[model samples]
Each structure stands twice: as C-alpha cells, then as structure tokens.
Target: MAEFIEHNLQGVDSAILAVPVALAEGIVWEDLARMVKDEKMAGNPIAGLIDKLHFEKNCMIEVVLALSAHANSQRWYELKKSQERKQGKTFTPHKKAFKLAEKKIHLQLSQV
Candidate 1:
C-alpha cells in the first residue's frame, strides 16, 4: 500500500492537497460510485482513490463509502464512528481498510 501511494504521488502536484479535505468532508456513496464508473475521471487520481476505496475491502457499497468518507486520518475514523453510533449506523473498519486509508491520507498530505 505504501509502495502504491509512493508511486501514485510521484509527479503529482499541489492540487492533490484538497482531495483529503474534500474526501473528509464526506461524500454520498452513490456519487462516489458514479465517479468510479464515469469515464470522465477514468484516469484521474481522485478517481483512483475512489476506486481503491470501493474495491479494497471487498465489502458492501455502504461500508466502502463510509470508510472512504472517513479516510482523512485515523482520528476522523473515530469521530465518524462516534457519529455513526449516535445515528445508529454501523461503521466497523478492518485493519486493511485503515491501512489503505492512512496510506491515501499520507499520499495526499505529501503533496502539500
């Protein structure tokens, strides 16, 4: 995962900085799924992140979406989980999912 992040971040410019924050802001799963399926952002890095979030866990769409939205940092996950608990939605995260999200955050932060 680290290798993948390093490779992807190479040659990437400052524009990537906004991605983590945007992702952190929270996105609807349908919108994220659409972005992955849409051809317009097929080769875009953000699309890659969307795709990674969707496919990495082999979980349901809702789970993937939740994980992706909470990918800003480890603390974000805890906060999101707290919010979900209050709202009665389950937000269980596997170790691999956290690692993937952390690596993604690291990659985006590196651009800054």
Candidate 2:
C-alpha cells in the first residue's frame, strides 16, 4: 500500500481534495462508479485523472485515514466491517468497486 501510494503521489492528492468536494456536492460512490465506467466524466472533477493513478485498496484506506474519518486503521477495519454488514457485501470496497469505494482514491505522503 505504501509502495503504491509512493508511486502514485500526484493522482492520489487530486483524489483526496476532489472527493470531499464531490461528497459535499451530493455525489455518491455509485455516481463515481458510473462516471468511471462510462468515461463520460467530462466536466466531472475526477475525469482525465485516470491516467495519473491506478486505483488500489490500500491507497483508498489511506485516503479514509487522511480525511480523519476513523482515527486509525483499526477503526477503519471496524468501519469496513460495519459497512459490509450493512450492505451485506464483502470486498466490493477492497476491489475498488465502491472508488474511495468511488472517489477513486487513485489520493500521497505529500498529500494535502
């Protein structure tokens, strides 16, 4: 995870900053998924960012941490479990199905 993040710094930072704004604007993970798949993300913030980073789960988890959502990785695991329980699904998140599980945390050490 650290290695991946180290390799993809620029894209990751974009994801971190862009995602929060998106969520504030009412964009959902599902919407991000559709945008990514359809490649119709023109005018969408994360569009054209694809080539900058490749989506990976560890990086996504790190993004969650950076957002101060969970305090620590253990809490993150708990959140993951709770989310799985609520959704009745497994690693849709870990597989990058969800994109931050769709902010596309594709977010860095030099991260903002």
Candidate 3:
C-alpha cells in the first residue's frame, strides 16, 4: 500500500499555496493563470478556487522575496554539498550552514 501524506494548513489561506507551488513547478503568474483557466474549463473544481483568491500587494511581494531566498539557499546548499563530495568530506556542516542561512533569511523576511 502506498503511504498517504496530508497537509493540514488550518487557518492558512489557500492562496499562499500558489506562490510556493508555482515556484516549484517553474510556472509564472501568466502561465499559472492560463493553466487554472484551462483546468476550470476541463471541470477541475479546485481550479475555480483560484478565482476567489486575492492577496494584498505586500503579501505577494513578501511571498516572492521568500521564494527567491529559498531558491538561493537551495543553490548554496547544492554547491556546498557538491564541493564537499569532491573533497570526500562529510556534508553535515554544509547542511547545518544551509539551515542556518535559511533561518536567517526567513527572519529577515518576517521583519519586513
């Protein structure tokens, strides 16, 4: 049997999912909007939910900045991991550093 994973984002608006998922899926706003429209036409009920969603300008900006920081941290982590692998060293430190950097970035984002 396959394991079932569920996310419980109680009290969190579903609109927030758009930013992270879009970034992960490499979809821009225009493309995502078009895809949503196509899905709605195809009778996907979830797609219709986007139509009712609205985010404040500041919230959108923050999401975009947070996503950018996440991407940067991911790249830094990958580079450090690769360099450590080449030197036959453990990557534990690199992983810790990445976590710390990510935490700092998030803190800065929260302050804005």
Candidate 4:
C-alpha cells in the first residue's frame, strides 16, 4: 500500500489528507461493504456491497475533486506570480483525471 502510494503520490497525498479516517482502516472490500450496507445479513450480500461500493467510490471522487482543485488553485497562483516576476514557470500539472477532478473540487470548495 505504501509502495502504491509512493507510485501515485498526488492521489495518495490528497486521499490521506482528505479521508484520514477512512484511510486509517485502509481500502478493504469487506469493510467498505459493511460500511455501505443497510445492515449485516447472513445471506445474499453482493448487491448491497456493490451498491455501497458505488456510494463510497462517489464519496472518494468528491474528495479527490476538491483536493485537486485546491492544489491546482494554489499552484496556479504561485505559477502566475512567478511568471510575473520572471523567476520561473516550471510546474506543469499533467493532463489526467486529477485535472478533471479539480473541477468538481472547485465547486465543492466554493460551497465551503
């Protein structure tokens, strides 16, 4: 998990910072299933688990979006300032899902 986090630094950092509680437990299927389930049952759990997984996935998406937006906004400000000062404009946010996530995050941040 730590290796995965190091490999995906941006996502891991945001995830760690944003969902600290959830991260503490780690991303386990059964735990997540239980979290989203309406109740624990002895029989037929996949449907509930899947539904819960979807919900949890959406929640994580929201968190990712918000974190990306905040980081992007800060970086944008610093980059612009540096460009103005002729110091440098070296940082370039890559084209990836992280960029799209920032849009959702920006909206969330606005509400906050």
Give the winner by TM-score: 2
Q: What does candidate 1's lDDT look like per residue over 50-72, in tens digits? A: 33333354323223223332342
- Tens digits of per-residue lDDT, candidate 3, 1-112, equal 0010012122123435554577578876667667768877998645643443223342332222233334434545666678878765556778889999999999999999
Clashes of 4: 2
User: lDDT per residue, candidate 4, 7-83, as tens digits?
Assistant: 45554454434334554568565565564353435443322222223334543322232344355445546666767
Judged by whole-model lDDT over C-alpha atoms, candidate 2 comes out at: 0.50
Give per-model TM-scores.
0.29, 0.38, 0.33, 0.21
- Model 4 is weakest, by summed lDDT over 10 consecutive residues, at 44-53
lDDT for each residue of candidate 2 in 1-112, tens digit (9 for 90 to 100): 3344445556556666665566579877667546555563455434444433223442243455154322333455666778779676555556666655345344433355
Structural RMSD, model 4: 19.2
Ranking by TM-score: 2, 3, 1, 4
After superposing candidate 3 on the true structure, give the runs of residues whose Cα lies further than 4 Å from its correct spot.
Answer: 1-15, 52-112
Which of 2 and 3 is ahead in TM-score?
2
